[model samples]
Target: MKILAPVSSLSEALPLIESGARELYCGLSPAAWGKEHGDNIWLNRRGPGKANLADLEELEDIVTLAHRKETRVFLTMNQPGYVKAFYPDLVSFVRDTLSIGVDALIMADPGLIKRVKEKEPAAVIHVSSLAAVLNSSSIAFFRSLGAQRIIFPRYLDLRVLRKMIEASEGDLEFEAFVLNDGCVFEEGFCHVSHAFGGAFCHNPAWSYKLREISSGGNKVSQVPAGGESFQQNVDEYKRWLWLGIKNFGGFPGPGGYPLGMCGLCALPELQALGIVSLKIVGREASLRKKAAGVKLVRKTLDLLEAGCSESELRERAGELKGVPGLCRSGYMCYYR
Candidate 1:
């Protein structure tokens, strides 16, 4: 299994590369968050603490660094519809990034996928997990458009995932989220955008809303829907969830809302089954933590490859625990 870590900063890049991360994924700037950041960088105004033109240059530096180590850099264009609708300028952003020649672009929107392919046919496109690709039809649609990989929706259990893999028949590479949080919504079915006037920023559908509510010294926003907040611009919402926000962790899976990080130590057993990538979440994670995560996954893969006893692997997995988020169990479908 190959390990892909999320890189929020150039600082996070090197250590993850050294620790055996085969790929890294992240947004270009605050616009990537859409309306969540609320600073209008997507509207072309300056966003506070946002990645700038300089940041893209720095990303080139990171890409150069990763290339030296033979690692891939996956840029996220995964915000459900938040970035594209709100930041139309993003068309150029996509063009520019592909021009820079990073490994692949992870995308969720079909229109965006069309646009990206139209402009940069040479750019590798990976279906973002936000696309909620639960069926083979969805898989075939992306394959027709030349998607190189699809990040399997986390809501899929091992059985459904296995079937999807079989159905793809090796036409598309499959990537799975092995660590960090996941949502309950069918990847593309989230309604937060429509509900919030694109202000709340979850899915690009324009069905979500954000009410400004006060919480302690700072104001906090909530996604009554799912996945919008986490996928949008800004960084690391998990810290707040870990601090006891019930909305993120109260659910058991990705049905109503999102749940927290999934621990997939059990996933290594699937390697022979043909999953291409084992992905970690949150590009915003600190350098040390991301690097540590990379090392942990690499070790896990090595042990699994050696045919190390499952008992031994289980012992190692005991060190890492899974957390629950707001996704209530039993609700299997996104809209129902």
Candidate 2:
């Protein structure tokens, strides 16, 4: 099993490389909200400036360092929107990336897959989970596009996943998220970002301000503004909160930390299945949290590769138990 760690900052990246992370995913800069990073801009709007994906030199450095330790890297281009809006620049990014000889590209956009085929034909593409290939037809579609592997979405049950793989007719590789948090909103697909801005919202800040409207509305909010601050319509946003749903569970609270053992526990099963990669969700993790999680995952993989038995795997997994969030479904098989 290969472990991929999340790199949120440059400071946290080196240790993960040394620890045994096969791949690391991170933004060009240390922006927590994803606004400052150029990639997020494309997510909001597919047009021109979105091509400023990130610092290529920084990515090269990460590639060089990871290569030194015999690890591969994947750059995510998971934006979902019109192809023509960002196709040209996306093509340029791929061209430059292939020139650097990075490992593979993780993507969800169909337009991107088409462009990659036209520009950097040899580049390997890993279908992002956002594409959610639940059926054999979808899987075949990606395979026909020359996708090397597909990252399965997390919502599928184990039985359905196994069935889908069995029914699929291609030789494409499979990747699954074994650990970390996943939003209810599908990555690379949802339009919540667009509600804030027509095409793009770079580092758009959202604010919560109380106000009074002219028509005697008790509580109103400032108009929704771009560039970082998003003020919800006082009445509208509050009505959303009152709705009985888990979607808004963590509206403004500090999010959960890394789960230490989640990645480690899945290694043995993944190895047994000969899976191509073991990815840990690190997009939002801090460098220290990222490092610790990577270390635990690396240590677990090492033991399992040495022919560790199921009993031993359980014990090792227990020893590296991850940090718990505010709420959880309790102990259960990760794949379940």
Candidate 3:
């Protein structure tokens, strides 16, 4: 399996490639996009400025450098869907990126995918996880639309993924999330906009109440509002969310790697199931965090390649992550 790292700037290219990323993916938002649509409207799924490369020039440079190392770079145009009005500009933007030698387009919207394929017949496209391809039929649908690979959505059951791969026809490539950034919901169905400040799920001020339906057909609190037991459960949920989002309270663990939702223990199974790429999912993270992610995955894959037993690999991965408690708890696991 190949390591696919996220790159957001020209400077991130070489180091990530050297760190064991055979493939790189990044988001791009041209200056004209913001000028025309304003900052609130995102050209891609991620926030504009920090998460994306600002111009094609930098992208071209990064592509050229990556190509020299035989590392492929993919550009993300993977919004769930866009307005019809944006198609003309979106198509043109895709054309420009392809002309500059971007290896492929990682996208979600079927209409946009069809449009791009019609315009650039030879352009390679990977269906983004945002497409939420959940079953064999979904895979076939995308294959018909000319997607060469599928980035499976986060939180899918491994058995389901394996069955889908087994049942599917043709030579479609499959990629799975191996590290970082877990979402609380399926991204394809989420309507809340992250283009503003952040996602609704990440709002810290939010609270939850557990209620039961009484025999009288009225609602009754299962636990008293703000009761100690209820408050403890809510606080525990928040901590898990925090660990998922910031990887142990916004800092690297003792092993110098971010400890977020991980699938390191599943690497052996994923490879056995014909998964072609393992994705590390933070394009907006700092350079150090990105590099550390690559290093951690690289080391883990090395152990797998060297014929470590599944149990041995899991133990090693937990040790490398330096959070055995988190590993044991299974809160940060992607495959458990």
Candidate 4:
């Protein structure tokens, strides 16, 4: 399987490629974007900040360098949806990037995809995970729109993933998350703005309460919530959320690797299932973290190629992360 690493700048291109990334994806927001739409509106889902490259020249440089190493570069325009007024400029921006030798456009908005295809029919498009493509019908819909690949969302069950891949019948390429980052809610359904500060789900100040429901189920009563068993379930859910948030503070686990959701152990099955690319998320993360992620996935893929058993691969992956306990607990598993 091809290792697809996230690139945030020209500087990160060579290091990531040298570390075994055969494919690179990044976001771009040109200077004119802020001037035209201001800071409130984001050019992509990541919002206007370090998550995206600030200029096109830098992207061009990164693309040029990546192509030299036989590595493909994909640009993200994967905001779930965008305002109608941004279409004219958005189309132009996409065309410019394609002209700069970007291998494909990673996009989520159907209207944007249609517009891009209309302007540049031969342009390669990878349907973004934010599109929430969970079923075969969604796959067919995107394929009809000239999408060459689909990046599966993080929450899909393994059975569903297998069915979807089989349903494709080798007509389209597939990419799945392999490391870093996780969302509490389905990303496509989340419309909250991050410009205010952080995402609504990631806010640490928020609190949760369990209320007793009336027998008729028409009202919530001001009671002590539930018995010990029910409260234990609630506590466990909270613990899951905390771990999902990387200990609720973005702290790294052992070896300074940013600890979040991971799918290293699923590599063998994904490769056998015809997955074309294994994506390493977190374009906005530190350079160290990004490099470490690529290296970890690279080592895992190498082990797979060496004919390691699934059980051995799982143990090695946990050892590589230095958190076998977390792996055993299923807290960091992407498939689980």
Candidate 5:
């Protein structure tokens, strides 16, 4: 199983490739786009300026360094809304960036796909998780548009993913998340905004704040967001607390440290099934974390290839995870 990782900066390129990242993906927010959309309103799924490389020149340097190590680089254009009005400039940017020697364009927007096809027909398009591809037909739809690979959504279980692979029958390249943060809802379907300037999902303070507000700050929270009554709210709070204690490795605080999600335990199974890539999520993750994640995945893949049992892989993965130990719940796993 090959490891595909998200690169945030030029410095990460060599270290990540050295750490065992054979494939890398990143987002670039040109100066012009940043000026207009500000920081939060990103073209891709992540927040601009924070999760992206701003200068194409620097991106080119990183790409070149990665290529020297035989690592292929993909650029994510996973914007949900890039309207026709933005086409001319958008096409210009894409065309220029493609000229910088990117290996593929990972995206979710059909309009952007169409535009990329029109401008750079030879482009290899990989559908992003934002596309929420749940089955073979959805894979076929993107395949028809020249998408060669599909990063299946986070919600898919092992049963369904295996079914999808069987249904595809060697027609598509399948990538799955191996490690890092996870979400509480379907990424493509969630209407809830994540910070940027609102009551977003990333903010863990919501749990406590909602509890207090639900009770009108009287210490008895009423109608716990989705549930009814103070007890139900209290139960929900306890559940979150329990989840924090179980999931977020070392950073077991209220925020859960990027919401405390992981899929390291699934690596042995995924590798057994011959998964094309195991992705480590975190475009804005720190350099140490980036290298450590890649190293962990690399070590696990090596252990698996050497015929390590699932139980053994699980133990090593927990050691790497470093906190909120064990894979006791499907909620914390990336592909349980």
Candidate 6:
């Protein structure tokens, strides 16, 4: 499986390319979209700032640089929905990217996919994980619709993944996350609003408010219905659950991005299953860490390719990355 790393700017392009990221993907926000929508509202998932490319030139430079290395680039326009008024501009965006020689567009919306496909009929399309494609027929349906790839959902189990791969019958490419951030909500199906940016779910304020209500159980231990608390729970978990997620390990450390989450141990299995691209998840990751993440993924892929045994792969993952005992269990692994 090739490494499909994320890039948000021209500065990140070369270092990642050199680190063995053969296919780089990112979200792009053009000047026109930002001007009308305002800078705060992103065209897709990542909320502005450094998470997406600022304009056409940076995108062009990234596309140009990656192409010079013979590395393919895919752009994300994977918003769940766009208003009727957005289509003409969306088509313009697709055409502009096609002009830049973008290899593919990764998006969840079929309507937007149709818009792009109409403009550049030969342009490769990748079904984003946000599409929540859970079945063989669904993938087949996408394949029939001109989608060349599927970014497999983050929480899918190994058995289901194997079944999906079996169903595909070598007709499509699959991209699975191997390292870093994953969604707390099941990625594809969650039509999450980007309230106070896309990091809304990561907001500690939600948990803190519930904590004041003295809520600390898998169920609602505290009732604030008539009070000032705004408590929302999920998977039958209480408010501390987010804190548990943040400081997830039985071991102590910061819970989120800086701490490594890995599926390197499953790489051998994934490759055997014909997954074409194993993704390193963060698009907004720091430049140095992006390079490191790619290098680390490169090492894992190399070790797997060099006939490393599964046990050894796990150990080597710990040695190179994938901090042992933190998210080492199946719940944290992408394929498991």
Evaluate all candidate structures by whole-model CA lDDT and list the values in order: 0.62, 0.59, 0.90, 0.86, 0.73, 0.74
Q: 7-126 in candidate 5: lDDT tens per residue? A: 988888888899899999998887778787565656677665567888899789988998889999998888666767877777787887788999888898877787788778988888
Quote the positional error of residue 127 for candidate 2 in Å: 0.6
lDDT: which candidate is best?
Answer: 3
What's model 5's lDDT at 46? 65
Q: Cα RMSD (Å) per model?
A: 11.3, 10.2, 2.7, 2.5, 5.7, 6.3
**Tens digits of lDDT, candidate 2, 174-217:** 77776655433444455655333222322223345555476565
lDDT of 5 at 95: 80
Candidate 5 or 2, higher TM-score: 5
* Residue 104, candidate 5: C-alpha displacement in angstroms: 0.9
Lowest summed lDDT window (length 10), candidate 4: 197-206
Against the true structure, candidate 1 reaches a TM-score of 0.68
The C-alpha TM-scores of every prediction are: 0.68, 0.68, 0.93, 0.93, 0.82, 0.82
Candidate 5: regions farther than 4 A off: 36-41, 195-199, 202-259, 323-325, 329-331
lDDT: worst 10-residue window of model 6: 249-258
**Model 4: number of clashes?**
0
How far out, in Å, is residue 280 in model 1?
0.6
1-336 in candidate 1: lDDT tens per residue?
Answer: 688888766777778888888887766664344555554433221222322223577678778888888888888777555555544466677767766768898888787788778777888999988787888888999888879998877656667777777787456788887665444245467654322221133322333344768878687766546564634423333333332222233332222212345434565545756887888765543565566666666766776777777667655543332222221231211111
**lDDT for model 1:** 0.62
> Which residue window of length 10 is worst by lDDT in model 3?
196-205
Question: Which portions of model 6 miss their true places by more than 4 Å?
Answer: 39-41, 195-198, 202-258, 327-331
- Return whichever of 1 and 3 wins on lDDT: 3
Q: Which stretches of candidate 2 lie over 4 Å from their true place?
A: 29-40, 43-54, 185-189, 194-257, 260-266, 306-312, 322-334
